[model samples]
Target: MALDTLDLGVLAAIVLAIVIYFTKGSLWGKSDGEDVSVPRGSSRDLVEILAANNKKALVLFASQTGTAEDYSHKFAKEFQSRFSIPTMCGDLADYDYENLNEIFTSIDGFQLVVFFTATYGEGEPPDNAVEFFDYLENECDDLSNLKFSCFGLGNSTYEFYNAMGKKTVSTLTEKGATLVGELGLGDDGRGTMDEDYMAWKDGLFDILKDQLSLEEHELVYEPQIKIEESVLTIDSPEVSLGEPDDKYINPSQEEAQSLNEGPFDHTHPYLAPITVSRELFNSDSRHCIHAEFDISDSNLKYTTGDHLAIWPSNSNEHVFKFLDILGLSEKKDVVIDIKSLDPTVHPHVISPSTYEAVVRHYLEISGPVSRQFVGSVAQFAPTEQAKAHASKLGKDKALFHEEVTSRYLNIADLLHVLSDGVKWTSIPFAFIIESVAHLQPRYYSISSSSLSEKQAIHVTAVVEQEKYPNVDHIVTGVATNLLFNIQLAQNKVSNVKPVVTYDLAGPRQKFAPFKLPVHVRRSTFKLPSNPATPIICIGPGTGVAPFRGFIRERVAQTANDISVGKTLLFFGCRNSSEDFLYKDEFVDYSKKLGEKFELVTAFSRETAEKVYVQHKMLERAKEISELLNDGAFFYVCGDAARMARDVQNVLIRIMMSERKVTESIATDMVKNLRVLNRYQEDVW
Candidate 1:
């Protein structure tokens, strides 16, 4: 039993490792060092994170992109700031649901668990939430001791409004989990998600006030992260100037080529060449681009009726404006390192990047400013008077709406309007990244059929440009305008005034042939399994994208000597001469389909009275009713707020009138169609 110095050192190291394992938790996908660095935006185990943070309640989020995640973080902060509750927010995908039962025994409090889930496409859970959802529904059952609260983020326009939220609440209750608050539902379709959330939280607080003995505190601004300025310049080889990952930041020729080989996905998109790009419309005021992406070498597969999510960069115009307002114009190229002060929270965007990179490639500097964000940034106003003005505006929801949201004024514009051209230099850079959402991918319904062309994905996007009454700058969509620029360059179209430009060459000329960063998002809106199954499509404007795919598939089926069923498409636009999308192609398809296909047109601006798709649907009530009776699949892809709602009502009326059924019966029939997957939608 001789204890040598080396033996003692080895023993000490083993003890230290065990201590770190329990205290700091697993380094799981992190660096194994004294100072660990977790990858930005990556999820960690919720149970471990909560334990390490010494938290009581854990807010688990099932986010599709980042909206649900944003809400979860906001709720966590509010729970702490308002009620003095120690909370931990985490992604549902990052934790094991099997250990959920242990939470009741581990945390000695009433506020144990909370769920925030976003419903994606029909009643499906988000991609990340899929595994967790399966476990909850199939595996885990006994959750009697689990006390939880729930909230749902969804669009009311969809048939299954807040479906995921409802499912989560019901499943948890069925499994014997104690529900704390009334399940909150937020509808983005009504443009009142924030209001709905606030209303729900107010009620939840009333319940929690007595249950947790919570005390309201004065709201104060707190930074979740801290920024460390780096010595690296924007031009430095190691510095990532808007490059998506480390591979793009600094890659050898072989590494770069290997990166492009396979697994072309959301994280690493293939720079697929654009084979075709042209204007689909003949309108002087509006422009719609039809672009075909060559995915021959991408190893990416997509069926008809799927979505192509194009990752877009912020326009230079908006980037410059934001940089100027933040007084980062002079130091745009200055590289900075962002790290989360709280071990539980992660930095929103990838770091070791320049200010210009973060602004141009990551942050959403275009959308309407939130009242909470306005309040958060008010303390950093250039002057005391400006601060007071901003604070007052933030406090008054109506005034904030009237001044900021109503005017579509973003953060840069709001600051400019309040400070009268003075810069908000005192505001921390980390706050901008945390406050503003990341630039999301614009999902377009695929217009090309997989049967017609397996190696290409077609997109029909109408460039959205709106001019406000008093605002000088035209509000142009970032992704649509980017697509327009790409089309211009591809077709050798002359540079038009007000056309938004991008770094089309991309970082280091990676995209050589008019390529864009994109990924395929599989959608539920699909053609029936059998070619003989009838289909009735209602698509107005660019909503006609997926219907185009469906028709193309039918045309291919007919060419192959396969018998096809009756296909009816109700399409609406301003006028057939100007804005009718794929006019020539439809004519060719109609020739092949003959009696099997029917195109119902609605030109709103052609006559004194406006005629929409819903009106066209009513005109063909007998046909639609007959088709539905024969088990026809109904598909709607367009404006969910008005067009989809109207078309749905028209269909119900058709069922009532033509079938001679009661309104309730017609409604049940429609609901039954949805339940049977006969009703499909691809609306935004």
Candidate 2:
């Protein structure tokens, strides 16, 4: 899922995590030529624009990444197009809450005010929405006349599901705003965000017709943007071609200057050298990489439990497929500029570059295609049969799921299937840019303790590969495969070419010598402040990354003669010899800590029946309950969907059986532990 609209402001500090319970990758490229100039409407405030345009509807978005912003824009566009309601999309950061009460009086009352917000980490609003959130919480009052509706984007896996959206609706109601419809919550964890959004909009529209006298107009395909060929040639140095920043456009002059630059962030990542690279798992087929990055010269610092974000480029194979399907492969080097014809519609990818850059660096051409996006492209289909198929697939939910989503078919793949190798030249490149999500950076938990290696950060990533049933090609995780390629290159490993290869040299060899652009991200998942605090960790497969750091820190502390409490780690894998990561290291640590450090293993393949971490936790129910009572900081890191939930259930069962508490009481106890920071999770 993409970040909220607020991501533009706070994206740098934010980490795009890929918690490999043996899993994932994403991107956010910042070419030096990337748009830095202020947007056109910067001078005029939201209220002023609303009044000037006579816009009755205002959709305010507080997006952590860009998903909320995208939804807000879509809503604004739909409202304007369908009901002829002048709607304007506004970022929460761009408006002042002090004058929010004037919306009713200043513009003869707003017909509608919609909020599209995403709840970020720990139930907090995105950084850009923080001021607005604060203002609503403390200062804002008396919105009795203001009519509104809300749609919240959230992952159900997180404890604070839809917190931001729920709080917004609550606060608005408290201030006496008339809620037009039920507060909509889109759960990304369940992959029902689109369905939830569509359903909510239906309810919202019905209410709008009765309240605001809105009448639906004929829905037609509207082009939100214009595309044109630029005079700039492919050989032009100014053209962006997957370059990180403008510094890379002319590296000779900027390289030295960049070296002396003070700050390096998401826009400008420090190219850290890999000091060591090796396979964690013993198996050849299923491999996990353990790599240590040298951040000594990057002026980057991180404590234990922090994350390291890696910005990755799209695979050439995927890029080529996208370009080829679009019939832009031959003219990929031809420069083009994309401009938004509608002010409400913004082009996600900055233009005035070759088609290659747009396909390779900007667009998310690898992910599953959205039905809405496919529907939009249907009108541009080359053949009548293709057009009919596309329309049916888009309109029919079941057909779409069966033919597209279930098949793991991306835009290019779907197009190929529909046209049978025919290129979609009729489709506008501008629309492609508008439809696709921006490439986001992938993050991994720093597996090395800062105390053990202050100047270095280690990451353990399992190369994700899964064969889709009935599909000819295997599904490969983008970032993990890239890392695997890098690992293979670094260790000089032979055979088994990875699914995709990367341009390791990185824009004129700027990132040579095994360098990866990365930055540190702070996390709440931390060990107890006291060294003597007992910790129970349940991490199966590559989820052991952070736990490795935790144990290493303790090992170093123990070596320094510091007293450490019992650290019981419940780890699971397919087999002990196959995918057991850091096995030798854990053995060595146990020898140092004696019974203070206990390593519990669950190898499913080793036995006739499958065993997992949850089973192990339940088996040691009494010991686990006793440790919890003794104030042990219980930690679980792995797959959020299944593993985390299962482990939590196991812990609750332990509490119920051993502590002789009811199920509800046990659940509350677990919740309380989370509230007290005694139950920490670093799941994906």
Candidate 3:
């Protein structure tokens, strides 16, 4: 059969089309019939989105760990429901701010823009909000017609407390945007962030009502998402039974092997194996863990002072308790599909997932109950008496604090008490999905030098367990307990019962025995690049994690025939014999480094006066001042609430005494050192 020129051309085009289809158009620029101009999700323009959706209010969040985003969603929901205004909540990263002024002109009537921003480390904007902040600072000039409000979530322990929120409000006001209410600041350091937010929100609502002449209606439960029971079972390949994403849900063997491949990030984590796990402290009452992760095959990289984020699932105890309280115990394994009721809203959790899997892997059901959330759920209480009690707990802040906050009662615990053995069956599943915050990864300081153990990351953690005076239940740390149980499993220890049981064998046993979903987060806390630079470290307890890495890094440099400088470490613990961490290792380090390495120990319990690291620092004030004059770097990593503050004050006092400077001048000198990057802190 002889083929003509036209026939051959057509055949060649058909073959190319098949190749493009199989490769998803990667082999070529684009598929022949593909429309590349179609929008993937939503319009990035603020004006276009607001006008298209006919939204009167837009709530945006710049969040690092999702706290600000959660608060924004709560605010948006409340504002819309109470004032009968159409509101849209979105991430700052998803929007284009060049048309900020257009939103004011395009949207008719009283349009509002609300910002819920969190100040990241060192007063930096969150990664998602960087672009928006850049636009606000550089491009935005006139927003005279715009009206906005801002609420900042911050830890006062940090020097630049609420910097982002304050900056945003200030910038907006400078651009002539009228503020709807006073700038709100929530202090996480004081553990009054929730209370602060609620108070600010109440006041903001009052202002909004007056400004818009809005008549508030009775608050009722409204579901932002719709959940339907699907016919699929938990065993179905289409259902995600604790899988992170579609790639892990019944993946092929080839895909499974490559699951830990590169580009690991917040959205995707590498399942790294735990190569080493052991107890650090000798005390029987207090436990501190030292675990190492094998990232050789995973290709996950880290530096000496970086952070390792560990993704953890809720314990079976908490998961089951949550299900039992919600009356979903019988239907734990029933698959359900979730859909967002509003066009602007998106489902946070993956579907079709079982109730147990959602509760275990997605939602944060074990945290302290929010007072506002308690009030919202009071209407759904089973009995009138329960409703009254719930309402009182929600309204009376002092009483609520005494009953719930002081005792550390989680949502499940509170519900169990309110129900008095009855299940909250009337509450909608969608409401639960909307109200509860999503589970976030826990971060730990990487306590290993990348130069020495390039393929491994180390974590030192103190197992947190608190028992309040009158509370029958003990509050336990989630991630630490998970690690402890994993350590117990890996060590083949049979005598000790598990503190909290987790699904160690992750979805389909992918993370069997001892493996964790982890990723590295780059940190600014780092040792000076020059090896000869002198360093002074103050770290108490597990705060010594990064300092260990720094010392190891110097040791590695010296092994390579590099000249190392004076290394001074001030470490504090309860008793030298009982809770002293890495005692033998420090001794070995002292031997290796000789006169260059010095370890100053402060055994608080051993001394009746309760001498701490600050006391030790004061004793060697002259040497510390001499080191400062010699351009030595100062580092502190410990409790931000007390220890970090104390260390800083002591440093200032030492400068005042040794340098013959005033107290104010010494304080300014420390501040200058921080600005020059000569002083660094990794507190809290």
Alpha-carbon lDDT, every model: 0.83, 0.80, 0.87
TM-score of each: 0.91, 0.88, 0.93
lDDT per residue for candidate 2 within 186-239, as digits (tens), equals 999999888788889878998888877788886555656667787888667666
- After best superposition, candidate 1 residue 91: deviation in angstroms? 1.6
- In lDDT terms, how accurate is model 2? 0.80
Q: How close is candidate 3 to the true structure, as a TM-score?
A: 0.93
Evaluation by lDDT, superior candidate among 2 and 3: 3
Error of 1 at 450 (Å): 0.9
Error of 2 at 326 (Å): 0.8
Give the candidates in order of lDDT, highest first: 3, 1, 2
State which candidate, 1 or 2, has the greater TM-score: 1
Q: In terms of lDDT, which candidate is strongest?
A: 3
What's the number of clashes in each of the models? 0, 15, 0
**In model 1, which runs have C-alpha deviations exceeding 4 angstroms?**
1-46, 82-86, 108-110, 202-207, 252-255, 261-266
RMSD of candidate 3 to true structure, Å: 5.9
